[model samples]
Target: IAKIYTDKDASLDALKGKKIAVLGYGNQGRAWALNLRDSGLDVTVGLERQGKSWEKATKDGFTPVKTDEAVRNAEVIIFLVPDMIQRTIWLEKVKPNMKKGADLVFAHGFNIHFRMIEPPADSDVYMVAPKGPGDTVRDYYVAGGGVPVLVAAYQNVSGKAMEKALAVAKGIGATRSGALESSFKEETETDLVGEQTILVGGIMELMRASFETLVEMGYQPEVAYFETINEVKMIVDIIHSKGLSGMLRAVSDTAKYGGMTVGKKVINEDVRKRIREAAERVRDGQFASEWVEEYNRGMPTVVNGLKEVDNSLEQKVANELRDLIERGKPKK
Candidate 1:
């Protein structure tokens, strides 16, 4: 059986007297640092000396220091930086400065799973990944709730890696909801596949295609935006609160029928085949290799793709519609 942990299952005692270094003041880093601090854990923000994050961290009441300095001082190092540069940072700063027997924590499994950032045998390596975005992580914590997290231990040199992982999850408030055990490979592969298929790439293409079809069929841009783009959140909200079948029952019968039928048509067997292919690429590391090459080349394809997408008529219309809605809103 999968080990699912709650706040009662994980105790903060495992983390007592441990000074935490949160390396990266980006959204996730900031959220984790604040949440851990609020949990009565000692936390420090680590950043590049000259970066904008230093100022942001300082403004948030943290005495942000250089990455090496923070790593040298802390017993637990939570690496929250972008994955592309993790190996570099690990080699040049983290590994050299970190103390023997200290814990190395990650929010994602990418670097460790791919063997890009190998820590020494003296360290404990683990992950405690919150399932939601950073904004919601902090927002929910402040509201006395928390997002779920996935916990995993890649190396247990300290013999208490699982305990430390669970402790960190509790410290960040994730155990207030739940923490599920996952392997590094499983988490990394599933996360990549989900983003490339349904979450980011597929949804964007679906919205754009639907909006274009409506506009081409002589619908007003405003109406097309409302149908294809604006109402997506409302539908997704219902799906989130309830399940897929519950969402269908809550809608009009005509809508439910059309959605049930047409959704299959839109995401047909051919798309399913492609989705399998995409997942295969991720599982075999082809996607990760390609992304690394893209990042190394300064993301030329991504830059051009973003420019093309942003310049599309759908985006232009969507911008205007969004502005109109904003203007129509009542002041608080």
Candidate 2:
């Protein structure tokens, strides 16, 4: 079994007294900076421009510095910028100014695993990927709980990479939940596969297909939205807190029987084959290459896809329903 760590398995000693720089001040960066500071660690926020993120850092009590300057002064640097921009920033700003033996950290293994941002051999390279969004991570930490995280070491020049990784995880309160030991490749490939097969792509497509089917069957769009979209959250919440069988037990007998008997037929061998194909694309680097190429060409496909979704009948119905629901809510 893979190693699992809790608060008892980690300590902040490895990170104590070290100057840590958090680049980006965006989603993951802001959370990491705040959590580390609350944990009594020195954290410096780095930004490429004096924009909204820079202002946010200042409002949060950080004297944000330029990316290169932060790299020059830190013993540890965490790259939390978007994946598409990391390679450019590393080559131009971080790589030139980073301390020779400074530790490099990441929230995801994408850049490293795909060889988009290769760190120097003299530095320790590791990852501490929280298993949820940054806001969720921070909220859970504040509630005296934590989101679980995966910790991995890509390189161990310092011979203590894993120790430092665990310390970083602890500082961010991830050890309060659990820290699962992993490798860069395992974390990267699995994350990609899950996102494509279940989390983002699969779920969106499933919802769209269900909504279309209900509409095609002559159901009222409002009723279809409630059944196919709105109630998904309720079911998902139950499944998240309990097991699949628990969810089945909680629902009506009709639901349980129909779901068990018909769900498999809907998601059968053909669907499984498509999911496997998606996983293969991720593992074989085809998806990465396509994504990078799309990014380089200014993300036309992504932009157009979003526009298509925005103009869809389903989206229009969703917006109207959401507004109606909001208007009905009692004022605070």
Candidate 3:
């Protein structure tokens, strides 16, 4: 069984009296900064001054400061910036200013696990990754609950990095739900594999293929949209709240029978091979290196691909369906 920690298993004492700096004000950064503050921790948002994030953070009641300044003053520094830019930021900004004996944290293990951002030997390194989107993280916290989190330690100069990581998890309300202990290697590898498979690439391809197949078979565009895309959320909600078996049981007998019999046929050995290849690329750092290079080159491939998809017939159908749904919503 997985070793899970709840609120009862964690304490905020480890993080007490430490000044925390949340670098970057993007999705995870904003949510974590607010949640930590609400949990009674002294939190400061660190970002580039005069940027939109600085203004937004200030409006949210935080005195946003420069990244280096924040690092200099903070005892616990959370690197919540984009993974692609972390090496540059850490080498030029954070590493030079961070105080000795402080703790360095991350919401993802990508940079650390890949050796992109190596901290000093004196500082502790750990991660507290909420296993959900930033909006859900904040929403659950506001509802007096929390999304699950994965905590891991890479270095433990103080011999209490795990305790501090768990405390950070608790402060963000993750312990209200549950937290599982993990390692940087495990988290990074699994996260990348999932993203490249079921979560992102597989889901997108499946939905698009389903929609195209329906449309090619003379189904109406709106009907195809409803069948292939719109109902995914409902199915996913069932699977998420209960489980796959629950979802199968909840659906019609026809659906249950059809899905069980044909699912493997659709995603058989060939598909599994491709998924393993993708995972291998991620595990070997090929994907990470290529992605960083693409990012550094202004994401030309990504932008062009997105442009093509934006112009696709499926996107057109999706846009119309979205507008129709919006127009039909009851007035507030």
Candidate 4:
């Protein structure tokens, strides 16, 4: 069985007096900075430019500093910047200014696993990846709960990398939920595979295809949207809070029977094969290479894809339905 850690398994001693620098003031960075400080750890927010992020950090009561300056003074440095920019920032600012043997932290293993941002051998490289978005993480922490997290160590030059990782997880309130021990490769590959196969790509395609099928079958677009898209959240919420069988039991007998029988027909062996192919692309680094290349070329594919989605009939229908629903809601 995989090792699971709780609040009892972690200690803040490793981070008590350490000067921690959090690079970026975006979603994850802001959450980490706030949570760690709330846990009584010293945190410095670092930004590349004195722009909106810097202003936001200052508003949050952090003495924001330049990236290089933060790295130079900190014993621990957390990189919360976007993956595409990490390599450039590390090379130009962090790598040159980071203190020797400083603990390097990450929320995801992408850059490290892909060798896009390789830390020095002397540093303690680790990850404390919360299992949710930054806003969710912060919300749970404030509510006296926490999102689960994955803890991993890449390099342990300090011989206490895992300890420090757990400590960071605790500081962020992740230990309140649980921290599952993982590795860089495992976390990176699984995250990519899940995102491609189900979370982002698969779900969107499923909804779009379902909507198109209903529309082609002569159903009203609004009705199709309600059935194929809007009710997904309600069903997913049930599944999230309960097990699959529980979700099945909660629905109508017709739904249970139809979903169990016909659902597999829709997502049959061909779909499984395609999903496996996507996993292979992620495992073999093909997806990473393609994404990196796309990013370098200014993300034309991503931009055009978003534009296509924005102009889609499904999106237009969704917007109209949402506006109508909002207008019908009783005002306070």
Candidate 5:
């Protein structure tokens, strides 16, 4: 169960004196450095000496140091590296530098829950994962808004796990909107399944299969683009504006009726059962194990899957649609 919080719960200034080391100058790292610096905290970005992000961090007014130096000094160590690489870095660079009772934090629970990165015995392990992409999180902050956040604590070695996690949420500006507490396992599982099944992996396959089905039946590429890919935004916009029924209300009654009738035929109980079974795999940690194993084996299949996407015709069509959308943007 997650204990969620709003703005009144605590103030962001609680981390004022802490030396925060954001390991890895990637998406979450940069955004956190910006937000935490603006919040009047001592913030440093840890990066490889030869890495491009060091220059970017220095340009943005951050103290950029090698991973070892940063980790050794910071009172709070925030691991913002990629999931597959974090554990290795932790074993090599982080675990040794951590002092007793320092806070170990994360933006996501994948590495922690998968046991990829193990923390020191005396430190607290908690999370403050924003429920959006890194760009969205940064953009929201710029607009004086904030994205929803999920905070989790797996350890309380110093009895400040929950409080420290909340402090982290505040530091990153997640408290401007709200934060929810969840288990490391739940957040990790939901996040992975959400990516692997619906958002990226499965949705791409579904969209391509649908478009291919239309084109193989003699639909024009332009028409298929409009109906399948181009209109995706329109459908998504309506879906976001309102629920599924609201989306139907914005469509033709015939289309709605056909959707109600034929949609079930296409996505029947068997299909739903398969989805449930997949969910079961997630709950049972099988999905995490498989993904971790794939990573450990040098990510051959994962690289191949990415190549499959790059070579996809759908990517080509999507790029064209994106260009048209960009072209229609108002002149600066």
Candidate 6:
């Protein structure tokens, strides 16, 4: 079983005087820098000299130093950048100046587990990933609560690397919520698969198929939009409060029976086989490897993916769904 380091074990003294560098003042980076600084730790924000984010970081009262200098000066370094560019940034700007035995941390494990980047032998490598998005993490912490987090120490060159990781979690108000232990590989693979299946890929396909089916059977495109995509939130709300059985009980018996019968046929043996295949593609890293490789070749994959997700027909359908939501549902 994985060990979850809880709040009772966290100590502010653990990072009291430690100089913590937050590399990349993006969403996670900004929140971490703010919370860590408020906790009285010496914190610095590192970013390239360009970009509007530099001005924002400065206005937020952090000395936005060059990447190299920040790594050299801080005792602990947290990288909060995008997954694809991290390894490159590390090799170019961070690797050289990283202090001996400096604690190198990440919000995601992409670089470490995949051998995308290797830290110097003298550095301590770790991760402290929030289970939620950046805004949720920050807002919950400000309210004296915290989103759950995952922490792992990949290398302990500092001998206290695990302690430092836990302490940082405390600084960000994670331990008071919950922080589970996971390896770099486990977190990385699971995160990728989760995004590929439940969050992005599978959900998108399900909505598209549902919409097309409704519209093909003579439903108006606007009605199809409401019946298929726009009601996703209502489904999720029911699922959130109750399990599938409870959700079934809450719906009208006619709708419940239809859902039970038609949903099974829609996701029958062939579709279930396809779903398994899709998950296997993620497990084999066909998706991640392609994404990262495309980045190394200048992000053609991201460009294409964005283009597809934003095409005209999809945009029209999405807009119609938004309008339907605003107009309120027709008489049930």
Model 6 residue 36 CA deviation (Å) reads 2.0
RMSD of each: 1.6, 1.6, 1.6, 1.7, 2.1, 3.4
Our tally of clashes for model 6 stands at 0
Clashes of each: 0, 0, 0, 0, 0, 0
lDDT, candidate 5, 78-147, per-residue tens = 9888877888888888887776677889888878786777776778888888888877777787777778
Candidate 2 per-residue lDDT over residues 213-308, each given as its tens digit: 999999998898888888888899899999798799899999988998999999999999999999899999999999999999999998999999
Reference-based lDDT, residue 82, model 6: 83
**Global lDDT of each candidate:** 0.91, 0.93, 0.91, 0.94, 0.81, 0.82
Candidate 4 TM-score, C-alpha based: 0.97
TM-score of each: 0.96, 0.97, 0.97, 0.97, 0.92, 0.88
What C-alpha root-mean-square deviation, in Å, does candidate 2 show against the real structure? 1.6
**Of 1 and 2, which scores higher on TM-score?**
2
The local lDDT score (0 to 100) that residue 184 gets in candidate 2 is 92
> Clashing residue pairs, candidate 6?
none
lDDT of 2 at 62: 99
Clashing pairs in 3: none
| Residue lDDT tens for model 1, 1-332 | 88899998999998987899999978899899899999999999988766788877888899998999999989999999998999999999988888888899999999999999988888899999889998889899998988999999999987899999999999888999999999888889989999999899999999989999998999998889888988898899889989898788889999988988998998999999999999999999999999999999999999999999899988888788887878866797
Q: What is the per-residue lDDT of model 4 for residues 222-245, given as tens digits with 9 covering 90 to 100? A: 999989988898899889999798
Q: What is the lDDT of residue 271 in candidate 2?
A: 97
Instruction: Supply the global lDDT for candidate 6.
Output: 0.82
Maximum-lDDT candidate: 4
1-332, model 3: which lDDT tens digit per residue? Answer: 78899999999999987899999988888889999999999998988557888887888899998999998989999988888878888998888888887799999999999998877888899999989998889889999999899999999989999899999999989999999999999899999999879898889899999999999999998898888888898899999999998998899999988998899999999999999999999989999999988998999999998998899888998887897877866797
